[model samples]
Target: MNRAVHAVRRHAVMAVGVLVLLYLFLPVAVVVAFSFNDAAGRFNFSWQGFTLDAWRHPCRVPGMCESVSTSLQVGAIATVAATILGTLLAFALARHQFRGRASTSLLVFLPMATPEVVMGASLLTLFVNVGVATGFATIVIAHILFTVSFVVVTVKARLAGFDSRLEEAAMDLYADEWQTFRRITLPLAAPGILSGALLAFALSFDDFIITNFNSGTTITFPMFVWGAAQRGVPPEVNVVGAAMFILALGCVGGAEVWRRVRAARR
Candidate 1:
């Protein structure tokens, strides 16, 4: 009886987990499906039939490609800037004793806790008062401001689990600070740093609220999608969405495979 009850509980947990995953991924599945739809009109709603036209001619929609390019540029810039700054901040916070450290940590996390609407509005007001023009530069700056908090938070979590004794052992072997860091500290922290960077890029690319406020005349992909929604969104838009999803999935799969390979070798 106990064995039967245990099996039923395990099956129930698995069923719930599967349901939750399906709930999350059902929309993604639909997006991928619609990318191949032969839309009867500007609206890519109902599936008429499957066609690879959109995949073949993703740039067939004029401004769509340009907007995607802008998003990529902004995401890259923000990811680099945020990752560097956040990694440094994470190290300082985790490894040092300094004045106002508590306050500084609080400030670092404030952006994460604060609502995007509030942050966006505040940023806009600051820009207006400072007479900074709102455009691509402003968008990148805004993204960095928000994304840094996430990067720092992520890297800090990694640092918390780090074995400082590894650095000490390296030092005992007469390795210099930079050498110990280069050979030991960095390699372990690299996964966290990479994860933070990927997260920053995703946030920057997907951001619409903050970008919209700071974009002015510049259009990113999310902004383009928002504007297109007023009109009928193009099937090519779905193509872009599907392509991004596939690319992200590929990166994640590649990383996991690499991790498993490294683990097996160890």
Candidate 2:
């Protein structure tokens, strides 16, 4: 009787997991399916017919490509800046004790816990108070601010699990501080750093509410999609979404392959 109950529970758990995955990916599936849709009107929600025109002319809608370009640029810059700063901060928090350490840790969680609308509004007010114009720079700054917390948390988790004895062994083998870090520490931590940067880029790319609050004249891809939704979304928007999904998948796949290759070599 107990064996049968256990078997039933295992099946139930697997079913729940599958349902959760379907719920999460349903929207993404819809977007990818609509990318090839030929619409009778501006709205591409319903399938009229299948066509390759949307993929061929992804930038057919004016300003769509430009907005995508802006978003890419911002995401790239923000990821770089946030990764560098957050990695350093992670090292400090993980490896050393410092004054106000508790306070600093608490502050990091505040940004992550805060509502997006509140964060956006607060940033907008700060920029206004400082006479800073709301534009591309402001957007980048805002993204970096929020993204840094996530990076710090990720990198810190990696650091926490790292074996310090490896570094000590390197030192015993006549490796100096820089050599130990370069030859041993960094390679071990690279995965976490890479993950943090990818997370930051995705957050910056898909952000809508915060971007909307701070973007005075700048149009990001998300903002462009919002504007188009009022009139009618273009099929090109679906194409862009599909492209982003594919690009991210490719990157993740490439990373996994590289990791497997390195593991096999070792």
Candidate 3:
């Protein structure tokens, strides 16, 4: 009787895990499926039939391509700026000691800890007080502010496990500070930096609340999707969503393969 009960519990646990996974990924699956949907009107709620028109002419909807371009540009700028600044800050926090370090560390979490709506409103107010127009520049600044915190946290986690003795060994071999850092430090930190950059870009691209608050005339991809949703979302929107999902999946797969190959080599 105990053996039978244990078997039932194991099966029940497995069933629950499967159900939770399905619940999480069901929306993503639906989005990918509907990318091929041939909807006659603006609404893509039901599948009329399977077609590749959305894929072939993803830019059929006016202004979507432009919005996508804007989003990419903003994401790129924010990622670059945040990565550089955050990596430097991470190094400082991880490697050095200074007054106010504790306070700085806590302050770094301010962006992440604060609610998005509050941050957006604060940024808007700051821009207004500074007499800065809320447009592309403001949007980029706001993204950088929030994304830097995330990058700092990620790179710090990676650096925390790093071996400083490796740098000492390099120095013992007569390598200068710059050479040791370039060869030993930066290379080791590359994975974390790349991860942070990718994360920052994804956040900037998908962000709507902050962007909406800061972007006066600039329309990003998320904003465009929001506006379109009011008029019944277009099928092409699903196409973009599907493509981004595939790209992200590919990145993760490539990273895993690289990790395996490196482990084998080691």
Candidate 4:
């Protein structure tokens, strides 16, 4: 009786897990399926036979390419800047203990913890007060500000688990701080740093709400999608979304593979 009950429970759990996965991925599956649809209207995903029309005819959709390009540029700039600043902040937080350290940590992580609407409004207010014109540059700066928190957290977690004696040993062997950090610390922590940056890039690329608030006339992919949805999305939006999803998945997979390879080598 117990064995039968156990089997029943296991099956029940598996069924629930499958349902949850489907619930999460069903929309994405539909989007991917419809990206190849011959129809022009995005809302009509009835699959009137598969064609690469959307992928090939991206130019037919007004502002699709421009939005994509803007998203890429903004994501790239924000990711780079956030990664550098966050990594440095992580290093400082991990290596040194100082007054207001707790406050510093809270401030660093505030962006991630705060509500998105609040952060966006606050940033918009700050920009207006400072007389900063809203555009791609402002959008990029806002993305970097919000995205850096994730990087800081990821890098700091790695640093927390790191053995500090490696750096000490390097120092004992006459290596300076810069050399020790570049040669020993960074090499060991590179996986986490890279992973953090990749994660940041993905977030920045996909962001909509904050980007919309900060962006004036500059349309990122999400903004384009929003505007297009007013008139009903073009089928090409599905293509673009699917492409971005695949690219992001590949980047994350690559980072994971690299981390595992480094670990096995070590």
The CA root-mean-square deviation of candidate 1, after full C-alpha superposition on the true structure, stands at 1.6
What is the lDDT of every predicted structure here?
Answer: 0.94, 0.94, 0.95, 0.89
Runs with alpha carbons beyond 4 Å of true place in candidate 1: 1-6
Q: lDDT value for candidate 2?
A: 0.94
TM-score of 3: 0.95
Taking all chains together, each candidate's TM-score versus the true structure is 0.95, 0.94, 0.95, 0.90
**Sequence-dependent TM-score of model 1:** 0.95
Stretches of candidate 3 exceeding 4 Å from the true structure: none
lDDT at 105 for candidate 4? 94
Task: Please give the clash total of every predicted structure, in order.
Answer: 0, 0, 0, 0
How many backbone collisions does model 4 have? 0
* Tens-digit lDDT track of model 1 for 1-266: 99999999889988999999999999999999999999988888798998999999999898999999999999999999999999999999988999999999999989988988999999999999999999999999999999999999899999989999999999999999999999999999998999999999999999999888999999999999999999888789999999999999998899899999999999
